[model samples]
Target: MNDKSQLVFCIGHCRIDPTDNSITFQMQGCSPFANETTKVSLQPKFIEVLSYLALRHPNVVTRNELVEQVWEGNVYVGTKALTNAIWHLRQHLLPLAHSGPVIETVRKTGYRLLLEPEYEQLNVLEDNLKIIEAKLDTANRHMQFILLFMSALVVITGVIVGVHLYQDNLRMIDTQIKVITQDPGSERYPRLSHNRRWLVYGASQPSGNKSLFLKDLQGDDLPVRQLTSLNSSELRAVWSADDSKLYFASHYLDTDECAITQLDLATNEIHSLAPCSSEMGAIDISSDGNYLSYISKHESDKNGGIYRLSLNTQNAKAERLSCELTCNYEDRDLAYSPDGKLLAIARRFSNISEDIIIRNLNTGEEHRLTEGLEDIRGLTWAPDGQRIVYATENSGSRNGFIIDIKSAQFRSLDIDGMSYPNSVSDKGELVYHQYRRQFEMAYYSLGGNVPSSLFPLLYSGGGHRNPDYSTQAARLVFVSSDSGYSEIWISDIHGEKLEQLTYLKSRVAYPRWSPDGLKIAFIAPDDSHEGNRIYILDLVNKNIFALASGYHNHGRPTWNWQGTSILASTSDGITEFYLDNKSPKVINALKMGVGFAKSSTEIVFSRYDVKGLWLIDLNYPNRIEPFISDQIFNAGNNWVLTKGGVYFKSKNSTEQILNYWDASTQQVTPILKLPRSSISGFGSLAYEPNSKRLVMTLDGFPQRDIMLLKHKLLQ
Candidate 1:
């Protein structure tokens, strides 16, 4: 629209890169050469789009090219995805974008990185090329050093030193992983009430199952009790004044009014008040249960808006308030004032954005409550009914502000970041889960004086990860979320230093810390090649060499006890990613294939079920041997090489039982029961051999949680 410098439109700004995960840039201090100060933190997809544009900066990337990079060529990131991200970005950063678009459009052809760059130094084009050249030199030198060192260690050191180095390398690769998160436990926020009588939160446990749990709001971290048994999807829930009925939204095919459902806790009966298949999300009801308001995503309306249903006369009028079109205005904030006489609505109409609009039902006239403040948050009328306070995420920080209804005055207050409550009681005290904090480790404290605080400390909201202790010497590595993208990251165990690994938009999966610990292997779907491939990252060097690309349908790669190579399972797969080569090389031609890699050398990997062990060796060529296949599925995981045999999960029929396989006698023994199939984040079952502990990753759907399931490992 506004053709200032070049309009750099980031479509899916929140996508993680595949090549190296760390380089994501969504909303930040500023895009190079721009004065924009505002940025959107609400959506991750938008961030991915920004990352893509930043990577290809100073280049004129066409819309189609933008789509491929941002969406990983997926249909989900369609027109809406593109436009929404672009629009939101403009809302936040266009002011800066006015100087010059880090992006520009080409009449035709895909997109090219605009030559313009504002690095405080080199021009944009020079910066891109310089980065590529530096990495190239680093790769060449690293390969030469590794080959020379490995050649000697092959027999004398026997891959002992090389493998250990490689194992540490895997740890370093995690720093580059992208950040992909959602409701984490469930689609709703944790709801806490003052009486401390109940600590409520939504959890989608047992995988694909959503339910609510209530726990003692007190001292002891007591066990949680299940409340609602709706196996389907249960939306946000709010407590009624009497606490007699829990009103929420549950949508299923049976209910025509898929919109509203009043769960009467007294009778445990689910009542459907309004019948409309409109998809419903955020809901806020009047304390007395007299009036209700919620945002509905419907097929007919196409563009989602605010809707209301009343309990009086069964609230029969049950109307759709198309203020966006009918009243020549758009409504976002839809909350009822305490007395219910004034509806405190956050309204925005295209050019004119977010302003609180108060509609007097008795007067049938609407008045602008808070204008010129594009900064309104989840608004709730104060208990006394005079003041309306809401959480506002303005500029780059999140805070709470209050507005007076009668006097039309506004005041701002600083509160803890947990202010993301969609529905709050009239009570000044709020109820919501505190936002997770993320740390950005910075070196050489700004001043040699004070305790060097970690830079970019999670002041507002961010997901957290367990800091890997003792790994400082080893290397702190893990998959992480950066600016809404998922990528591998490698850092000092202290998390004082971090480096990102993946650069492509495709998501990286199952980063394995090699036994030798020099290299890490993971799966990345390369839509460009139209197939999944294994990517091996060299930690010390930051060189990414595709072990295998589209040609191999292989996945879940694990490093062998010897770090020089890796072991992977697949079907009709190809060998190491072939780039310069014109022809394809098949590593296997069978149904379930197994393969191994010895540096540049590789052979098929297979599981000998008859002998009951994994049997793939790089030196064996087509031959497969019996390793240690038990009754359980050890062949699948990065089978742990521990003092207490190999631990793995075996899915017999209904249950995925945890079991251990003895290396000596080759005996299989069951350990403990598990929650579901596969570990969280698809991470391998980490065997703490020193402690003989069997640890499994607990699943945190929407977003994975760092959970440790400890058990005794049979020696």
Candidate 2:
């Protein structure tokens, strides 16, 4: 193996100090006294693969060699497993690769370590300690006596400070939280004025229109005044410098237009300032109140990007902040730094993955703050501007995390249902939005005597979604979080004989049954949380294995008609997986494949950089055209393809409607209107061709409100 002995003589074992427990992997050229170091714990398999590659440093090892050595020649398991392990190992090794990739991949050959491996050995630590002990007796007696005296004094001082710090940390960790608004409707994106007395938020009414409401936080029993009565939705509001006006995005339903509007709190007059996005994205005002920023996409652009407009200049157009390098993804959910010098934004690389990034407004410099996160709902800067608190969703659960801007250190706030973190007041009070939601499967029939009725398909709770029905076996499979964790579940059509399949406690979603009904395929994050990958379960043997698609992130998957291969969306695009092949084939590298048509000659899909649904005909694969190009479709996950055409969800001014497009006639018709108070809209749509039965997750007893966090740490 390319002179393994050469590495032994060149760098020795990876020398990590025994006391440094925070460090998992450390490489050469990284100084111990550096201002910051990347600390991450490595799994055993990651270390083994890394050590093997290091032994053959600067030499490409074939794929077969790795499978034989690491996985004991089980190519079926090792093929995609090796790719996943290597991808995660690279992420952990990123901080050390200042010059280049520490592990280099030779295309079509294999991977090799570019840097020499140095690891700590047990014997090395013992020998170093013995050497230090031997030199201790050579010191003078007087100097030794002075050292002992100082050591004892230092110990005493450390104990006193340690106790005080411990108590302070306890208070910060156990911060007191209270629900401020308990309206029956959903209230979202609360904004606290600079004076911390007035709070404004968007409240979803029974009519399905979101209106701005103002509340006096200082008065406990004061009635909240309705701020706006427009027929549009007001989202993501920010207070002016004097707290006399509010700036927010208004999405008009009739004209399908979105604009930045200024609301005079004193006179209750609303005026449109400039055009914005209708996606309920983000809006914020600079600390100095001279500029207003929001996410918008012009007619010429494909995706939303951060745009800034000058409030001081009359009729000033919104300028798009072009991201030439770092801000390359679709940007949303932004907050201005307290000093207005930097902006923290959530950068979405795809539907399933995004992370937090900071940008310098003047110099156009950017730095990534977080990585491998999913569904970043909202983020806000701390009052002092030294830290940021952002909320993200995994499966059905919501979580909050706080990160220090300079040090890049982050920790979970241990708060549940923290959807949109709006603001943190200077007086150590925080206000945000929390949605109390429970999703259950709803069933309906089209032609039967059901009379367009809605009934619960399943009895249990905890967010049931992504239902798939197998006509052959008369079985239905879906994802549910009832066990306090998202897991795969299966039952009959009537929701009887419910059996829990996998106990993977992590987030699981999008379970699809094979055509034969003998197997099921789903997507979940790997152990390292790299990204969601596809896995298959055999009902006959009760065994499970991952379907390696050679990509890190994967979305919803669909089984082909024959059930020999599966199609899914990954980081590369649409990929097809086979039962025997170790490598998957990428069909379309530009679009995300949602599902396959009945004849298997057409694939329904969407794009990351564009809107609207499109179809790819296998006969002429290069030609791509729109499928349902008219009107507004809610989300990609809220649609399904069937023999008739497509059954999708759309929203009007009052409520969500289920619409179906007829393939034969090429016409769109509204089928059913959903509940008006659905905060978290419908989940994945499922339809069985033979029975003409539809199953979807519906929000039940949806409640959302503004919450206040009283903590010393907020200050």
Flag clash pairs in model 2. Answer: 13-118, 13-119, 14-118, 14-119, 14-120
Q: In order, what lDDT does every prediction score?
A: 0.48, 0.73
Tens digit per residue, CA lDDT, model 1, 184-281:
45333444443536655555654555566665646445666666665455635666666666666666634434647777656778877764443335
Q: TM-score of predicted model 2? A: 0.70
Structural similarity to truth (TM-score) of each candidate: 0.36, 0.70
**Which candidate gets the maximum TM-score versus the true structure?**
2
After superposition, which runs of candidate 1 have C-alpha atoms over 4 Å from their true positions?
A: 1-209, 215-223, 253-257, 276-280, 314-317, 324-330, 348-353, 371-377, 395-397, 406-411, 422-428, 437-715
In order, what is each prediction's RMSD in angstroms? 23.3, 11.7
Which window of 10 residues has the lowest lDDT sum in candidate 1?
Answer: 706-715
| TM-score attained by model 1 | 0.36
